[model samples]
Target chain A: MARASVTRLTGRPLLSRRQDGLALRRAMPDRLLPALVAAMTFLAALALAGAVGASLLAQRWNNGAAAIMTIQVPDADAPAATGAGKRGDAVLAVLSHDPAFAAAIPVDRARLAALLAPWLGGAGGSGTGAPALSLPGVIQARLRPGVDPPADLAARLESAAPGTLAERNQPWTARLVALTRSLQACAALALLVVTGVAVAVVAAATRAGLAARRHSIEIVHGLGAGDGYIAGRFARRTTVLALSGGIIGTILSVPLLLLLCRLGAPFASGAALPPTLPDGDLAAYLSDALARVPLPLWIALPLLPPVSASIGWLTAQFTVRAWLRRLP
Target chain B: MIRLDEIALRYPGRDPNRGAVLQRISADIPSGGFRWVLGASGAGKSSLLRLLSLSLKPTSGQLEVLGVSVNRARRAALARLRRRTGTVFQDLRLLGELSVFDNVALRLRLDGLPEDRIELEVTEMLRFVGLGRKLDVRPHSLSGGEQQRVAVARAVVHRPPLLLADEPTGALDEKQAIRLISLFEELNQMGSTVLVATHNEALVRRFGHPALVLERGRLVSHG
Candidate 1:
């Protein structure tokens, strides 16, 4: 046995200070287990972000993109076969009157020409540079919730003009929704695995602590220390360590989360990406990206320390109590 | 006070024939009575003291310590019973990590004594054991006789109603042995039931107390 300093021992205020007689500071060290927990927390943070992001994306796509139905009326300026009004007018009247369609707005000619200018020459579509060629009219229609587009919509429009196509992106939107749901499920599974691994890590660490302090524990037990007293020493030590690990992991996840937010910025805000800058604008980008991390994630990330501490405390309590059962 | 009626302890996973270390042994010690546990090596003296101190549950039969039945008592009830008892092991099981003061204070701390009371009691006990100046020193820094006194101080610091000592004077000289026995005698006179196990017949004859002698895990005589 190495000799310890007498003066240091005497300097302690009372014998009550090291009430943890098992010397858990020496038995269960503060380093390795927290590091493992920190790694687990980091993965957990990523999984949480994925789950939240997938859910938000699904909701936005469902409400905005999925409900929109576009109907294109080509040769739009031609007279109606009913010979009463223009072909585009006939189609617009049918969509606006239908209760199944919530709203419809016809895209005017100038904006339509500018939109088609990319495929046709700019002068050919604009009447200013040359005689304007016939261009399809686009009407972005919104479908009412749980309502299907009438199958006869294109047929009714064709009565007015030979070819007017009603195109709905519903199939593609459905596929995207399915994809995001599975992504959320996968993220949820990852969270479960990380949580399990953390519990196991804490359990293994606690068992090792018990083994290291076996003789001291038995001696203390012989001194009439109850099972609660022994288990409390371990549980308190492990909880502090786990909390430290969770804090470290949360701090480490910040940069990663920020990067993911930046990558996802355009889709979330429905804003166009900024043209390339020399990163003098990086601070602005960073601030914007930080804001994009959901409120729920902000709330959830800070809670990791407490959550992990709870896990560590409960696991250590159960483990130590069960281990003490082997004693007399 | 202690009472044993056919108490037996069998540690499992040993040589099958030698496994039952103490078998159907019986004895009764009145309150404040002193007894010298006499046995040759492998004669189960330690095991008997172990049972008396509530360190081992008897494999079968009855043991009543401090008027509480050992086998039938709940774990918490047994713990409360154990706090009333103290034992000085042969190996001097002092926690090497703690100072002498802390070591002696451990029992009172377990009893939830107030901080000032624990300090006062531990200091007084260490001084009584003649280790007052070495209160802050670790057990390993003490000599063998000093360590033995420290163990004795810790065991009796709580002033338990029951005290058991096993080979307490094994490493002590004749004078030190007499001094240790005198301390036990004083504690016994103070109304503690003290039991000492020893292999020293000369010391036993010198002290001249009743002896419960054992041979091969069986009590041969009590005279």
Candidate 2:
């Protein structure tokens, strides 16, 4: 026959060496604190994930179009101010010769129509033989590193081709950086708040445990157990609870994080992932999905438990020690 | 030895007259001395024991237990002194969650005694108290008399130099109470200072030890 179980069916280890003198197991129940801590850890994980995601986004934007500048010439087919070629061709020649820019790519009418297809639906029309709206000639060129975008480059372009306008992308790049920094700051603040809340949760749970076991505590204390002994017991218990909570919270956050990374993968890569997945290969899909999360996050997720345990240990130690001052 | 000089205990409050528990009481007991603390229910016998056990700091006074000045001792020093003392409460404050053996072994364990030695000592003490078969039994499972014995066993298991019992056998029958007192006498013979507080004049007469008598928060008699 099964024993009439007084203790809840816990996965307590079969063999034990040390004894719990205070019987803190019954004094501090395992459920409420760990559950609350797990919730806090989950929020912390998300906050950290957000910070990491913002960093990756900043890197992507920095490496992407932020280094490129654009030059647009109106009335491109018209005569150039230089009296040598079409205005658009003149502007291209000047840009191509300049050491500051590289890989000057001229946008043709059909490509221009495709670019504008979202705004002007007629871009999808008739083979694009001279777009209905007379679009300016658009030229994109990568700005080489250490290349000072000459302040007078726009004037030079205007001289080569009348009405040519140079759009410096540097300000927008700085703005993007500032935006990402703001996002990272917000994520950092969220992380600090979450950690603060986790500490508070552990502290409150510890106080409750102390209150619930006042008699037991008084007995041990009266038996000559020092503040360190009593506080150490509470710290050990809370550390285990917080560590377990952190591990569980981190584990639970993984799939959700993976899904989020997968959804945001297109924004990072600047293109949609191909839908044609190979059939009947679950491992392949899982590996692919795992690859979506950043390597830094992989390293960081495993650290939450130890960090959480440290917080719990420190919080319980101080709280219990402070509370014991009321005893003697 | 224990020394007290004009010790007073009072609950801090606006009304001074209603708060004093033990007041202007001074006494001394040498090493290896045994004395019964005589008082009524509302008298301050328990509070005096609480002061000796280092669980309560007197509101104002001088107290020295086991040669450490209770008034000036650091908390850590007091804890060390407390480790050298043992107490058996009237309520038999056995940790309900622990078994009889563990309750008896708590002080030794806290002192970092070796497990094998602790087990041996706790087992012997339990047997001496006639609860040898109930080593693993919880305190609540025992009868009132048996529970008092457990408390007594725990108090003396470490052979503390200063043994203080606050109504130690208040719940025991005459046979059980006498047996418990004999245990204290045996410990006192073994060179421990044992102080038992009780209102039972019959028990006091049976033991015929010197007594410290209190009335209305004052030490009324000592012989």
Candidate 3:
């Protein structure tokens, strides 16, 4: 008389017996649950990926920004460039002598010219028939970890080499950190909302399914089937459906994710670009402005299906048990 | 065995006040007793059977079935009580998608009986009810009499101590009805307490079993 023994005798699995006992008919059209779950999971995966990427990008930018300083020497008094060169070399020599500074390198004219080429038009220098622009001499410094440059270091450099300014550029780095944090928060919020909506959708469908099978359920209950027995059947069915939909949704999202990655690849790979650029190099400038996400973050995408399945299973169990309490 | 003490069943109505379906009704059916509940249509015969089967709670009375005081039984206890009894619904509530064999085997399955025993018992019961050939057929595909037989087989396949049938022969022809009554008699002789509720007084009179009569939701006679 045990259900297990009966299943063994009938050669039907437990799920088949439960489903068959409920009289599988088109009485309940539940095609929507899986589809909805799949769609939600797809959206959730994308949001999760975005949040992870933003977090990693923020950390990278914070570390990179914290360890660097820039020194700009203007050519206001020198003959078009000689005075700027001497002041830049003087600043580099000063930085090199400090034990706290790991490296101090001067930016060559060709590299500086190339950096200004986007705005001035053509290649570095005046060779590309672009406007002749007076650019400053720049020195880049790398500091040892935990080393704070002396607060009076910039004043000392300015007094020794006139018309030169020193900057740690912490404010810009702070702004970038804040922006990435906001983006990560938004992505997390979106993920939570999508998962909640998916669970709600499954719960609603389970109720409808129970309503359609109410008569059969009553018959089974009258015949001595326990509430746990009935609820297990529903939970199993919904779990399978939700898991399938989640996998499909996750699989479908891969192409979209790849396309997004491709679109942002150029920006992620390049150095920071100026705010304003010539009309022709806008794509390149945009590419340089964005950072490519690291590979490890993709691992989280595969976990969505199982998470969705667990949610579906719990929702169905709760819905069925609550509904059964109202029965005789 | 079944016992009722001033059992009153009142279904909630759209209006705030409605009379009980069965008011101040009391009766006792001893073990192995074959009883006929005779009444006109809507005389609460089905309602009484539902109470005996533990499908409904008495509004203001006590009920005992198979030695268990079911009126105050918890859900799990009621389920155990239900398992000891079998009911043949008036509408023949066989799962339409299941084969006749599966329908009859369901009761034994619920009891967690072994597969070989379920198969042997279900097959024998179907054969006794003259439905052996239709074992693989769905209930919807069977004739009315065949469907009734399927319901009867399903009810008694597990050999429960109490068997309650509500208008089981309503859909049968005279010859088929007699055959069904004989089958019930055979089961009664095997020591199950049988209660058949029907509006067909002639059939009840012909069998001449100990009987109860209900009139307008009240027990009018027990003889």
Candidate 4:
């Protein structure tokens, strides 16, 4: 309410132009120094985890359509000995007639046999042996694209095929989803713990500064400077510390995260493919998802460190302001 | 101009019966004059200063400073009033962390004076107080007399219309007290109203000035 001119409290300005760099350096000892290394390590871990979790969720969400399971039913007259012919007919009848099954397009024998060629060794392996040994009777039906298979769909299919068992591919997908969520929660918890520690450290340092400068405040008051002027100095100092510490902490965490990500690349690469894609070429799976993922992570992963730093700065500012209000 | 009419003050204590520290007592110190309020320990001299300085409001009377009715003034107006005056504490409240030059420059700077002006004015004041050589030295490193002078320099730096000094030379030798009192006289000559609360009778006789004496929370005499 007091629209007075902005008063400078001393010959020294609140923030010097060129001296900001020097001030930032000075801030390191008081604010940034202690938390710098820890903050970096914590933030890097947080960012990497966040990137990984987000990527996993996005990958799962994006790849919702790719979770395919096929049951191949053998030909009607292949033989009655393996019970393959009867089961194959039964599957065809259910898929075509059951209203619950919107459309199940059966693949031709040649295509199904071709699909299995790589795993069963189509012809002869260079000096290895013949490809086909024995084959199981299975009905491969491609469910209507983009339609979610219901929980009871498997039961219905099993009932339809009297002697056949139905298998759903979603349980493994659900497990992967749960793991991603758990990792995200763990990262979030660690970030919170680091934030708490940062605030506590800054608060303690500020209190010590206040105690040392108690006479400075009293003298200013005695010289007719009010509470606002005294508080302004403290708020400015701590804020600088918070921001600088954040920057330093973030800088430190990046390289550490890169190293860890590099080390974990092999395991993550293996996870991108299904066991059914039995060629097992590491390069193929690497190309399948890893390439798509790193870009998203690279773009989004760098944001966490700065965000953590801002949290630190904000906490320090509020704490100092609250402490100053108690002064007479 | 400072006026306290039928003023009363009290501090929270162990006993409730002794409610008011200074009962309904009225006093005034006119503008452009020096007034030495003489009182022994616990005689409420400092309480009067507190009331005049707008540090504490009187419980039961109207008070004014520089023709502004402080009792009815807004918080902003009161702060303006406070800024227009300066008080040197009995404890010589100089910011020990800052150098002597900085301590003196504080008041002017708070009023938003430019850096060059602050530098010139602070230099002049430090010179006047004979601490020019020790400009960059912090107060805690200074001697008792030098520290008291720095406190004086800070109080008078802004050249406020009103000045309050509580035992300004309480820790000084007789010669130093005389020099300090002369500075106060010079300020008064320049039209700043001066009020000194002291018990130093020898110093009072040394520099003959009008005096107001207090005893047992009551005004004993005025001259």
Indicate which candidate wins on DockQ.
2
Candidate 3 residue spans exceeding 4 A from truth: A1-19, A25-31, A74-90, A93-103, A120-134, A143-152, A155-164, A266-297, B1-5, B14-18, B27-34, B64-77, B173-193, B200-212, B220-223
What's the residue-level lDDT of B70 in candidate 4? 76
True contacts kept of each: 0.38, 0.52, 0.41, 0.18
TM-score of each: 0.87, 0.87, 0.81, 0.69
- Report the candidate with higher DockQ, 3 versus 4: 3
lDDT of 2 by residue, B146-204 (tens): 89889888889899999999988778888878888998998899999999999788899
Estimate candidate 3's alpha-carbon lDDT, on a 0 to 1 scale. 0.79
Off by over 4 Å in 4: A1-33, A40-44, A47-58, A65-67, A74-146, A149-168, A263-313, B1-25, B28-33, B47-82, B171-186, B189-191, B201-212, B218-223
lDDT of 2 at A320: 96
The order by descending TM-score is: 1, 2, 3, 4
Model 3, A138-173: lDDT tens digits are 888878877888888877677657778878856797
Error of 4 at B130 (Å): 2.1
Superior by DockQ: candidate 1 or candidate 4:
1
Q: Please report, as a residue range, the 10-residue window in candidate 1 chain B with the lowest summed lDDT.
A: B11-20
Residue-level lDDT of model 1, residues A179-285, one tens digit each, is 99999999999999999999999999999999999988988888888888888889999999999999999899989998786677577657666544336787777
